[model samples]
Target: MGSYDAFCKLYSKGLLFTKPIPLKDGSHSMRNIIDQLKDSLSRALTIFYPLTGHLVTKKGDDAPSYHVILDCTDAPGAQFAHAVVDAQVADIIAPDDVPPIVESFFPFVGTVNNDGHTLPLLAVQVTELVDGIFVGCSINHVVADGNSFWHFFNTWSEISRTTFRNNSNSEFVPRPPIVKRWFLNGQGPIINLPFTHHDEFIERYLPSPQRERFFHFSPESVACLKEKANAECNTSKISSFQALAAVVWRSITRARQLADEQITHCWLPVDNRLRLDPPLTADYFGNCIQALNATTTAGELLSNNLGWSASLLHQAVAGHTDASIRAWLEAWVRTPFVYQYGQFVDHQSVMFGSSPRFDMYGNDFGWGRPLASRSGNGNKFDGKVTLYPGREGGGSIDLEVCLPHQPMKALELDPEFMIAASPSQAF
Candidate 1:
């Protein structure tokens, strides 16, 4: 787990998935769905057993350091809660901004990942709405990244759908996770941290208050961004994701109204699954990601066109080869640093996580596809952006943008940004 040691102080990643229910079935339908999900989750954990475990620290023999490890000997199960909300589906999906009530759907809002030692690494809350259902999942960041998180979710839904359709009493998993943790050649399964106590390490960690809004980009809009960027650059090297990220970076920087000379950064979490020497399997069940930074002065970024910013992002991502990834790992092993909240307080920056390429709309547990998707109130900060595949599918993308109240209001009014974004009600 050396690769994920830095994420220990961060908050658990939380996601909320909602779908409408038929009105005729009433309470019985809700009860049946909850029961089925619980049973299927129980079976899923047998394969993803580490999620049900707790993190423990041990003293290193040679150095005055602590090593964190998952302890599943007691088989402490994951938390599952069922709650009933008075509101209907329209109350949540109708708002232009993500409603405050959406955060309540999740199990852990402000809990940090280090709390996994005492709390369940994974906690799920099934909030029953008047005319819909919201399934909220909070998974410890140290245990899994977005890929692994969705892998477990997809498998759980598959199990539930299979059982519902077949009405059989057999355990089956469509895709099993690769639980073997990967490490550098000289690295160990025992990852040592410089901190002696968890409290002292994370005592200063505090999340800033922010407002989150969803922006939907249709397939045509995405294509336009890519086309315009490529035409400006006089090359077709800029990918759609790069072009989209470029627009977001420029728009937010403009909304923040930073000084022309100010240094701004855009950090992206690059997946290392396929970028390693011997590439790990796609289903490798852990955090195998590195934060890659692209930087420029505010003046340069704002003065340039979208293609310029897109090219910068493309270069940063393309340069993260296998050798560079290993070098980063080796450097971390020498001096382990646990990333805390507000790590970028000194800079005007943006951080991107949760890719749109994941199978966001495919988690159908015998019901129809999801009507919408949302995130919990954990790990949120100004300038944090999470991308999801649009519910409409195709090449469409949805961005969940978080920022301070004033900047968020300004961003909503920015014409350049609004031209590419669909109205919030479209989802």
Candidate 2:
């Protein structure tokens, strides 16, 4: 394994901890909360076990370990705490709208910034509102997935709520810590899995710059839209997600026609955490396993009805013979031929992330549940949509489109492209 590969192996096996300031029962103090976290945090680490590789370090800690960002952003009405919460997260701070906190979360592929440290491994920030507080974070991709992070957060919340006295067994036990050792001799690209037709893959999804922007289906809108599409397709199993994906695929193709490009790569993340036998714990730390480069022709993707499309995606997932895809990915990282973008294409580049099931609105980190909560906004994306389950069976999705401001203006004008369900209908 190259140093970078070995580094990744050591790296992906990390975890993140989050604390939502709970509804203060009128007597708890910040010092009291910190004191409790200090005692219970490490113990909670045990529940997250082996995958919790190393406790993150600050700027000059005496350890042979690396550091990550713990960025914190402020809410519209949040009271800023200089040492704990800042007006913006650490990455995006500039002449550009990108906040410093967003910039801090970029991966450390070996670029130094003004801070002297690699880009943040942990991003810590807060969303302040009259109701309660929201703490936002960005753990390194190498270390944990959203499930694992939420698992840890739930445990921390449990401990904090009970003042470190709640001792119920969590859903999963931790694994053994990964020991880092040299395995390769060279560097550059270190993963190699066959995606038989890479450009063909790209052409299907990322065809044009116009399609490479963001689009969202509000939770309220998505639920109703899915129902309408299901009735049109005559299939009850057609979930909002499947329907949205189909529309996104179609819209992207339309965008490509306008832009006159044929990029075709749509990289969708497959959550393989539960794909394992005896489903992994929500806190099963480390990079569990993810499948990327799922591709299909635009014509094929858009022509299908909701049921057909959902079934198609289901089939692709079922056919993945590499049940041990995670191990395969880790082992593949040892080679240098896997990360190549041979004969790059400009089709459609779409990334999809399922929303995390964190009960964010209910998170009361001792100050009472937040009146409202939201994600930090320093990050940006093009042609990507993140899905989160909402108040009921419904859900919220965050979209980051890279279209020029003018297209965005056009999108707003076209009500059919984006619409929301009534509040009564929305969960």
Candidate 3:
């Protein structure tokens, strides 16, 4: 794994994806659905065998200079659970804030936050609702990114629907994931055997209190923002993502009222699987994302218009190239104990993640399409904003934001922020 990727291993926040699976009949009881899911996942383990494996770390110093390897010897099968909530499907999709009820729908591994490197790196929980079933997954971030994680999810759904409809008990083929590390150092997911520096990075930082809120940006509003941003710069055109992120970043900075001299950053994770010199294939899994950032003083971000923020985002994104990615990899190998940049990024840094590219709306598993989707509780961090395709499915964007309570309230009254936003009611 890349040193930067190893940092993720220190924390065990996995992606949780939930979609309402339609109930066929009374025969499709929670027990029956759970059984089918268990069987399908058991079969899936043969293909995604690595997930059945666990992460093992050798004793090391204070930071992430230790040897952390995947131990596949013990086959602790992925977790499977079933729960019945009083809420109904309609109640879940109601035009309101993401119900706090869905928080209990998540199924974590070992414990909610376990530092132990035991086996069974993956787990699933089938949350049963009044009229529908919630299929939720919690896979370790070290094992996958948005691309690989969704690949595993869709593949599991395919196998699930195939068996549910055909009821065939025969061997099935699942699209297997490639385990090779890309642009990483070492052999077999190991290099520097001492992670003391990473340990310090974790201990050095104190987490600030945060509150999460959901916001909506219709397709028309997104287009308007893009149009305005494009109007700002003739040489550099910002993408829709740039425009949206710029707006949110600026809005949050203004709400917080950081000092003019204070430096704030927006951590934007770039998917490098397709941006490499030769480029990685679609199936190449593991953490292939590198966080690129835009740095601006509080005064500049608060003083500028949305388009100005978009231009800064565009430049930050434009800074990444094939050579730069390769250079970053080379530099990482030369300096294993320290990360050259992104060290100061903390609660003050609002990171933008997820995109329409994930196609959450396209995931279908024998049932009708999902009415909505959301990231697991793991994503709730101060100054974090996630952009997902709207549940309406015509390319509108939904923003899931987490901030301080004061900042969130400030955002509610922020005219510039509210002019283009509505309440997004998907969890």
Candidate 4:
């Protein structure tokens, strides 16, 4: 097996990390919080493996792993002495502006913080306080999925709690690396495409029109939506994942209709950890297994009932013996086809549901659980959906909608699209 250092290049290539805040209050100390996070990260750093990458722009590879820096926003700091300031700065206290880590990995990479998804990926701003602390980090998806990242974060919290007293056991035993069962020639998924004469597939996937963001729902609200959906579809038992899938599928379809588009597509990233015998440990890094796919056309999708639509989605992703999904993902990841074909998907959305509930509630970093948790907006996908465990026993889903301003307005008018909480408008 290749050494952990072999995986460092891959880990650095894949963006995997998150911005977490303790609370929204303004009394927390940035130094203490950073120290805790630094310790937590250091304990888990070995598991993350060698941080490898070369900055081709300057022809140098020596640099510290990404650091936390504070960017000044209009939000207030400390006492309520200043004017009604509302700017927010990064929780990380850095001396000055730093180039993005991604830039070092991929030359000619775009740089700018615009929409919700891309914003976090580029740079995160933190607001420090006693009631709560804000963190901003753009975690790339190539290294570890939500599961891997959570596994490490939880360990950090667990160890941090007792570190002051004694060296807690934050054992990060290296998990067996994913076997290179496929040919070394395999290029991975194909994501690049040529649209029209000038537009590229990647651009279409990350449309400039839609602003990416994570929208969260309370446990009660999620249960209510799922209950209503279940009642509507009596034959088959549906999950909150399916319910949200139905809603988003329906919503996207409706948006397409208003936009005067008929043909559409959607992709779901399938996890193949369990599909393998002696399933990959929670620590397994790199791309394990995935399947990128499209649903029925918009015309048919819109005409069908929610239950029917959900059933179709369920059927598309069900069943697995060996890496059936992995085989598909390998084909895409190994090739440049995804880059070419994605442009043809006039209306496409990527959705993930049924995420582990343990990721959120269990991630207590000393100051109790986070008051709120939401999904990160990514510029790579048009629409993104993530589901977390609700308070009761069901599931809650966060959705980020990206579309033209007119379609967004129409979405607001619909009864199903309830405004949960506004980012800029509400505190």
Candidate 5:
């Protein structure tokens, strides 16, 4: 593992995918769906077999200080559950105000592996609704990040579609993914043995009235924001993602209403694969990401226009080069283990991550495209914001913002913020 991978927080993430009705006639039976899913998953296991394994600790000379390794030799198969719910596909997609999106959407209850049950790193829950099925996945973060997770999901879907057509395993072989974690100069990745992670910084501090909201920005709205941001910066160019981030940062900053001298920061995850000197392929299949933070005080952030914030984001993003990225790794080795992205954050900070280029709309296991895609976000705290593409099929974007109660309500009331995001119908 690289220096950063060793201290990767041991947590689980859940993904919810709903498959609507009108399957190829015979494919809707609960038994048939489960059978097909299990068989295809079994085939997929041969490729992503490492995920089936559990993490075992290699004790050091110290007490709780140990190296955690992925041992897949005798791994139990990935967990799968077949549940039938009485809710309709429409309700599942665009429910009226009901429950927390993550709480009600994902099938998994907890985000930890050793929280009582000896859980597999990967588990799949096939929830059958009155109209279709919801594929809820619980995956350990140690083994995969967003890129690797989606790769596995898409591969499984491909295998299932092939099996559904031919009913034979004779013609399907997925390309092997690189599993070797990179280490620098033959040096070890783990520095602080069994890093001690205390309670998250946010849980103890963030004020009451916490909530998660899903907001949709259509392609037209996104374009308008980009145009406005570019105009404000006196620069003719700004990306859709940058523009959206600027708007969000401004809205959240205004809502929080921090003192003039108080500072706020925004962190964006930069995919290190492409930033490396010798770039990794799209399928490098690991946590090849780093966060780029933009710092500004409330007076600076809210006082200036959206374009100023966007320009700062653009500079941070453009500042990453191949040599700089390598140096980033070197610097971390000298600093400390566990690059806690949340370390500098407080109630006033906002950490933003967006996978705008990911093919979130393409995973079709025969029942057609997903109306929406969501991360159960078990590890996220208030002031965390994640972006996904809007389901409307254009250049739209989906923003899922988590914040304290008052600030969230303030965002809803903000005219500029409300103008961009419509109520998400099915996310």
Candidate 6:
């Protein structure tokens, strides 16, 4: 978990999954659905018991610094809440952009991940919408990354679905999580943080005023982007994700209207599970990801074709081998560094998170598949982009883009950018 200490100051990752209730007479009642979810969550916690635990701060024996550890013994269970919202599903999905009320759907709106010490590491809100249901989950990043977050979610839904089918908990978990946290051989199970006081270490980061918008790209559009990118580069080395990211990076840089020579960065999180030596399992339940940065001058990025920008991103990702990952871990263990909120405020930079590869639309809680997915007001900053698998599946993608109001308007009007993005609708 030392690899995840840097996330302590960051906000919890919040996601909202919304779907309509079936009108069938025998369909599960809202009360019944909530009860089933609550029961399944409890059973899931038995396997993922650490989530019910809190972070314990301990002082180093040799130094005056502090380190954090997960304490699960006799801890209280995860937090669960039932909520009622006076809105319909259409009110959420009919908008040109995500409704502001969506933020209220999630628990722990502004809480940082470090608050897991006092707050629940996992808090879920089952909001009852008029004729619909919204399940919002906020998980501490210090405990899990996006992969692990979804793993727990997927398992919980599986348990709920199975229980609903059998009308009993038969101890069925499709993929039990690997709770053993990963660490370097010589580093430690005890990781040291730089701060002494909890208050000094935690930050309740509030981003600057920004407008959030969802852009949908159909499979055809994404394929066209890949084709054009490959044709321009005269190689098939650039992948679909790389090509799409390049388009977003170039377009956002153009919209920001940065000076040609100004430096711009595209930071992408690379999952190191497969990139490490001997490789960690896909189900390893913690942060095994690192942020890889691709940088270029704004002038160069704009002057080049989409393929060129994508090639830069491709190289960054390809170069993140096991050796590089280990080197980063070694350096971090020597002198730990935590990410602060303000570090992501650069106007000329874009940070891509929440992979479209995640099984976002597949989480079915026995009733139905999610009609749409959304994020909450956590870890959002200017140029923050979260990618979700399109509801239509296949190769489609939904980009939840956050930007300052002015640049967002400019981006919306940018002809080249909008050409590839499908007609905007609520995701």
Q: What local distance difference test score does each model get?
A: 0.81, 0.40, 0.69, 0.42, 0.69, 0.82
- What range of 10 consecutive residues in model 4 has the weakest lDDT sum? 1-10
Candidate 1 lDDT over 1-427, as tens digits, reads 3344433333333334454443574523777888888999998899999898998889866665788888989868899999988998778777767888887888866777877888888999888887778888888888888889989888888888888667765776667899987889857888777766776566434557778888999999999999999999999988999999999999999999999999999988888999887898898998888788789999999999999999999999999998998888889898888775556544379888888998868888777677788888766678889888987888999898989998888889888789999865443
Clashes of 4: 44
Q: Going through the candidates in order, what is the number of backbone clashes in each?
A: 0, 84, 14, 44, 1, 1
| lDDT against true structure, model 4 | 0.42
Give candidates' CA RMSD values in order.
2.3, 10.6, 4.0, 11.2, 3.7, 2.1
Question: Which portions of model 1 show Cα errors greater than 4 Å?
Answer: 1-28, 61-63, 345-347, 425-427
Off by over 4 Å in 6: 1-27, 425-427
Off by over 4 Å in 3: 4-26, 59-65, 90-96, 109-116, 168-176, 183-189, 196-209, 337-345, 423-427
| Candidate 4 Cα errors over 4 Å, as ranges | 1-28, 50-131, 164-207, 212-234, 258-261, 292-294, 319-323, 326-345, 348-358, 374-377, 386-394, 417-427
lDDT of 6 by residue, 80-117 (tens): 99999899888877875677998888887777777777
| Tens-digit lDDT string for candidate 3 (1-427) | 3453433322122222343444677435556667777888887778788778776766555554566666778767687777778778766666344566766777652232123265356767777766767777777766677777777777777787777778776565545688766544333444664344335433222346666567888888888888888887754478988988988888888888788988899989788877776788878877677778898898988887788888888888888988888788776666655342246346466887766666666666655567677556654567867767887766688887887789889988888899989665544
- TM-scores of the candidates are 0.94, 0.57, 0.86, 0.61, 0.86, 0.95
Which candidate has the highest TM-score of all?
Answer: 6
Query: Which prediction has the highest lDDT against the true structure?
Result: 6
Per-residue accuracy of model 2 over 1-427 as CA lDDT, tens digit each: 1111112211111111233345466234445555554455555555544333322223333332232322223111111121243432211211112223332222332221111123433333433323223344444444455555555555555655555334343433333323232122332222332333223122112223332222434576777767866786666766666566655544545554433334344545566556655455444455554545545666665555544555554445555443555455456554323221222223255555534345544444444433222232211234444443442334764343444344445544444455541222111
**TM-score of predicted structure 6:** 0.95
